[model samples]
Target: MTIWTAIFLLLGGVGGGLLSSIASMASLASYPVLLAVGIPPVYANVTNDAALIWTSIGSTISSTKELKGHWKETWFFTIFTVLGSIMGCILLLSFPSSVFEKAVPFFITFSGIMILVSGKHNTLNTEKQPTWLRIVYLGTLLIMGAYTGYFGAAGGVIVLVILTYITNEKFIVINAIKNVISGFANLVALIIFMFTSHIYWLQAIPLAIGMFIGGYIGPAILRRVPEKPVRIFIATLAFVQSAYFFYTAYLR
Candidate 1:
């Protein structure tokens, strides 16, 4: 890649990482950049997964403070997430290029709406989480993890929502645990992708560096900004992207 292309990928990683810390959908920003830079769609997707693996390292460290004493709480969920991610990675590599090509826009649109509507509530207020609910959560995580392993734009957001429903934990703690475990899920999938896929190393290296920088910025910004406006802004952006995805996927 040229120096300019490298620079763009770097910035894309930074943006992707920062956005990831907040709500997940960050890949939406970087994937297009990869395509624009001449990476084929499948290669761009795989390379994005490769680069995004590191973005979680820093974010997970920061979230650990809030996750203290929460080991048992997270164990089962983590297992499901890891298993799901592995399944997803396998599915990803198995698919024809045309499959992912047709699926991408739909995935984006679905994930976007999920983040937007789910953002409205801060927590699940119901008394007991029914066994059925946990089943739904498990099934959802598995599918989402596979998708995340394949194309992780808003994986964190999905985790956050599921956790919110499962427990009465503080939002901060829930979010922190979400980061660490999701990191694990992505890490597992990323390693698998590294061996099996055509990772755009030239692109991934710079983007990973940018993600490291951006991860730091994201939490700091969230601390300073009030919650409502931030949610509004993020939700709005997600909605717009969702609309775009819908248009691109099924419409045209």
Candidate 2:
């Protein structure tokens, strides 16, 4: 790519990573930049996946504090994340995302509202669950993981709501778990995509670099901020993401 294109991608990555680390939405900042640089749609999608790995890496590295006690659960659930991602990757190779894309706006908007209003309901610590309920929870995670493995536009927001509903962990802890596990899911998709020709590494590399920097910085900011403002910020981003995708999926 040209030096200017690299610079633009780098900047895009920074914004994407910052937003991703903070609110689980990166495409809002990075995906359009990939398309703007003239990469084909499928090419941009794969390249976007490649670059996003760095955001997970950067966020995980800096989020050690948030992830501390949650290590066991994170690793345990990541197996399902990997498995679901394999299915998603296989599906993506065979299917057009048009149908799923049509449903994304509603999911994003609903998840956003849930998080915003999730005050007392979300604050409750984990309660003992029955055996059947646990199975249902795992099944849900698998589905969400598959979604993350797919286009992953607002998958994080959906995950944020799901984790909150099931575990009811503190928001920061839930976010940390989401980041680490989602990284593994993306890793599975990356491995599958690596053999394909769609990934434009020239575009992905600079974006990854910028994303890593932003991801590394975001957790530190989150650590000091109060939860309410962060919740509002994420909810707002979700609404914006929902509207943009709505236009792309239907209004257009």
Candidate 3:
């Protein structure tokens, strides 16, 4: 409620947004800050998804240049993602957090490995993929979509890993594509949470603002940065996320 609290939340948003665009792991920055700022675990996660809508918007707006010809791919993936997100949201409300919390770290670890093996993903000819492979890709996206709706800590990273398998585009382009797809996952969660979950508007406002700013600049940063290091960076974050979640889920 204090001005300082608002300022702090804004700063958290900026950092979350930056990490989101650059690494697909905004929750690494935002989740803890929400907890630090005194939001309960229950509200923080939903609020994070709610504010993240701006991250999607900010990145998409800035991505106009990169997205010039990729609308078809972006929207196509969204269809599966939206359905999965709805399922995820329902599961979140219907199930225990421990269920996904225990599984997410593995998802993160798989994503890290996927990042390392990205070259192989790019070698596949998307156009020539068999119908079964195409189904697998969409199927994976649907499952990942549910993941995004469930906890969604690093949902973008999860999507980024699968995207490489199907799109074969440059990392920058993949980043842009994941932004819209994962953003919809969170956006869909927000829409559902608006009716069912508790969203702390006070923190959500500033967090949204910061993520928007960070998301806008992330794509441009990727455009200039080399892909090798960015891949390493994202993979590293994935491992760290996995380790942290494992500790929380099994150890602590």
Candidate 4:
């Protein structure tokens, strides 16, 4: 790769990292950059996954303070996330991409609406959710895990929205968990991809470096922002992006 391409990817990674930390949409930044630099769509997606492992690492380290005391509660979901991720990887390798590609709009739209509605529910009501609600929540996470493992554009927003309903923790705290769990799910996929030839190490190296730096910087910015505004902003972005994806997938 040329030095200019490397520099462009590094900058993209940095932007992606910042957006990821704030809105969990790092792929929005890095994926397009990969395509612009001449990587094909499939390779770009896999290479993005490979490089994003570092975003998780960087975010996890930066969010250590927020993650404390939540590990016990998070462990159970983490297991399911790992399982879902593995399942997603199998599906990706074994099935036609169109199967999932067609579903992306619905997934994004549903997730965006959920986030918007969840904002209306009071987080302070500590009463245990009904059994059905619990089941639905777990199911959502499992599905989200699989999605993240397979094609994780805006996956973090979905995870963050579901987390808001299940836990009363501060948004930043929930976001921290979102980072770890999403990172974990992606990590499983990355490891699986590592054994394959799809990864472009040349592009991945600079992207990873950029994401690492961005991840670390993301939380610092998050701390300064008000929670409600950030949530609304992210949900709005998700909806807009969802529409764009739908247009490209169906109408275009």
Candidate 5:
């Protein structure tokens, strides 16, 4: 609530936003920052999601150019994401915190393994994916989106991994659509969190402001950076963070 805290949260938001544009792990950064600033874990997670929601808006705008005539295709996944988010959050709420504690390590390790083994495979598209396989892809996303709504650290990465199988779009475009769908998923969860969970509004306000600016600048930076390295770096960071978070959650 102090001016100093406001300043820090704003800085965290910008950093978080930039990360989001690249990898969708903004929550991993800002959640800890909020906790370090004295917000409880529950409040920190909720507020971080609230702040990062703006990144989705910026990403959606940037992605619209790439999507061109593909909005219809995107909508089907978006609708599933929205519904899955609701279901996921409900599932999360149904469990005790201890359940999340036990599952965090498994979630993180699975994601890390997927990235390490499948990064090369990610380059392949769905030119040959059969109809049944497409259903599997959609189902995976829906299930993962639900997880994202519940405890989304690398939820965007989960979507990215799945999408790499279905389309040959540029990673940036895939990331942008992931943002929109995940944003919608989080939006629904945010509404529920506001009612059922504690939210650190004072922290979120500054973070949201910073994220707005960062999200706007991320794509331009991406254009200037080398693609393969950026993707590799992000994947590495996500894996490391997931490991750390899982470790911490397990110890709790």
Candidate 6:
């Protein structure tokens, strides 16, 4: 790889990791960088997925305080997420990318609205969760896993929003769980992608290194910032990203 390409990817990884940790929108940073560096869209997507495994590692380590008592739930959800990611990988390999590209903006916009609405309410914390609610949560994770494994633009935001409504925990804790689940789901997909010829290893390596550093820094920043502002910032970012994707997919 050229020195300039490596530098770009490393910088992209750092930015992607920070965003992924803060907003769960790692792809928004990394994917475009890949494209700008002249990687094909399909290869860039897979390469980005592979590199994101490092983000999970960094996030998991940094968020351990919040994750302390959540191990059982974490493992429980991970199984389903892994399954969903595998399915998503299969779909990506088998289907046309256009179908997902068309649907992404709507999904991102809906997820952002859900996060905003959920943040304003106390329903998730006050009410006793029923068995049905647990089932619903599981279902949401499965779907999110598949989505993250496939297209993955703002998949973390979607996961965070669902967790917000289902769990009574603080937003930071929910975000920590989101990181674990996202990491594992992507791990499954990365393993699958390892066998494929699509991953651009030259780009993926530098990106992974940068993301690892960013992931470690992300939770530290979260801990220092107030929760409300972080939520607002992430929600706004989601909406803006959604609009940009919409314009690119249809208007452009």
The global C-alpha lDDT for each of the candidates, from Candidate 1 onward, is: 0.72, 0.85, 0.87, 0.85, 0.76, 0.87
Would you estimate the TM-scores of all the predictions?
0.84, 0.94, 0.97, 0.94, 0.90, 0.94
Question: Candidate 5's error at 204, in angstroms?
Answer: 1.1
Error of 5 at 206 (Å): 0.8
TM-score, predicted candidate 6 vs. hidden true structure: 0.94
The sequence of per-residue lDDT tens digits that candidate 1 reaches over residues 182-224 is 8788789878877887888888898888887776566666666
Worst 10 contiguous positions by lDDT, candidate 6: 121-130
For model 3, the stretches where C-alpha displacement exceeds 4 angstroms are: 120-122
Q: Alpha-carbon error at 110 in model 2, in Å?
A: 1.2
Tens-digit lDDT track for model 5 on 1-252? 889888888888788888887766787567778988988877777888888888887767766676677677677778878888888788878975456666766665566556545546545647676889999889888887788777676887777777666677776666667777888888998988888888878778888988887777777677678667766767777778767866677654
Candidate 5 deviant stretches above 4 angstroms: 116-127
Instruction: Estimate, for each residue in 74-146, the C-alpha lDDT of model 4 and write its tens digit.
Output: 7877887888888888888887667776678888888878777777767444367787887788888988888
- Candidate 2 regions exceeding 4 Å error are none
Kindly indicate the candidate among 1 and 3 with the higher TM-score: 3
Q: What is the lDDT of residue 234 in candidate 1?
A: 60
How many residue pairs clash in all the candidates, one count each?
2, 0, 0, 0, 0, 0
Candidate 1 worst ten-residue window by lDDT: 96-105
Cα lDDT tens digits, model 6, 45-156, are 8889888889889989999999999999888878888899888888988986577888889998998888877878765542577888788888988988898777777888
Error of 4 at 21 (Å): 1.6
Higher-TM-score candidate of 3 and 5: 3
Candidate 3 residue lDDT tens string, 108-165: 8988988888844446778888999999989999988888787676778878888888
Model 2 TM-score? 0.94
